[model samples]
Target: MADFDLEALSLSELKKMQKDVAKAISTYQDRQKAEARAKLESLARDLGYSLAELVGTATKITRAPAAAKYRHPENAAVTWSGRGRKPQWFVDALAAGNTASDLAIG
Candidate 1:
């Protein structure tokens, strides 16, 4: 590494140098990460598995189907899984003084 007289440098020049050093470090870190990832991928391929599979990130995420938790009173076809936001029908029923238990599916 080259020695520099940092104390002799003007404040503006020091700031510019700092910025340049920061940029260089960032670029070097990015290159290192890319190289590491490439090496991992190569090793994974040699092991007969993809990078994601080797990391256990390639597994398909599956969820059990949502069961009908609440059914519309007037329309049996209309249903809510009661997992997320309440449906407008459920809200309307609540506004009209119908309890959530009133719409519970068997």
Candidate 2:
């Protein structure tokens, strides 16, 4: 590392150097982690297994969106799958004494 003449540096120069040092320190861990990941991936490839396969941390399997189970009383386009939270229209319909079976798509 080059020796910094701290006493010779002006206030602005010292502040700039401090900022640069802080940035370098902050990114050092990220750089190290990337390098380690690359090495691990290479080793896993040579061993005939992917890193995810070995670690069992593969991407999650997502299901297709649920089929619409309920339809809006007035709007055919507005529908709900009946899986998550009820929609405002559905809530209003229920409050208006409309049973859930009344909105069934069938």
Candidate 3:
């Protein structure tokens, strides 16, 4: 362990040291976790089963991007899926007395 002269360090130096120490701690923790995981995986393999088989790997279910439900009146390329917050152009069209159905794609 390297001895740091805390009393001799300036305010900026102390802050930099604090940040370095925090980063080092985080890096050390990540390394430890990786090592532990590797050990567990090796032990699991030795027991005649893979880590995923023993732990039950999570299957990520992701939805495909929503089809464009509305198209820009002026710019045909600009479109929205009618999901989440309304876009600025859509809001403007609505403000100009255009109905949602009017802006909707065929």
Q: Judge candidate 2 against the unseen true structure and give its global Cα lDDT, from 0 to 1.
A: 0.95
By TM-score rank, best first, the candidates go 3, 2, 1
> Which residue ranges in model 2 land beyond 4 Å of their true spot?
1-23, 45-53
lDDT value for model 3: 0.96
For model 2, state the Cα shift of residue 56 in Å. Answer: 4.4
Q: How would you encode candidate 1's per-residue C-alpha lDDT over 25-79 as one tens digit per residue?
A: 9999999999999999999999999998867675688999899999998999999
Q: Relative to the true structure, how large is the alpha-carbon lDDT of every model? A: 0.94, 0.95, 0.96
Q: What shift in Å separates residue 34 of candidate 3 from its native position after superposition?
A: 1.5
lDDT of 3 by residue, 9-84 (tens): 9999999989998999999999999999999999998999999998898999998999999999899999999999
Question: What digit string (tens of lDDT, one per residue) describes model 2 on residues 35-98?
Answer: 9999999999999999999888857899999999999999999999999898999999999999
Worst lDDT 10-window in candidate 1 = 52-61
State candidate 1's TM-score.
Answer: 0.55
TM-scores of the candidates in the order shown: 0.55, 0.65, 0.73
Q: How far off is residue 97 in model 2, in Å?
A: 1.7
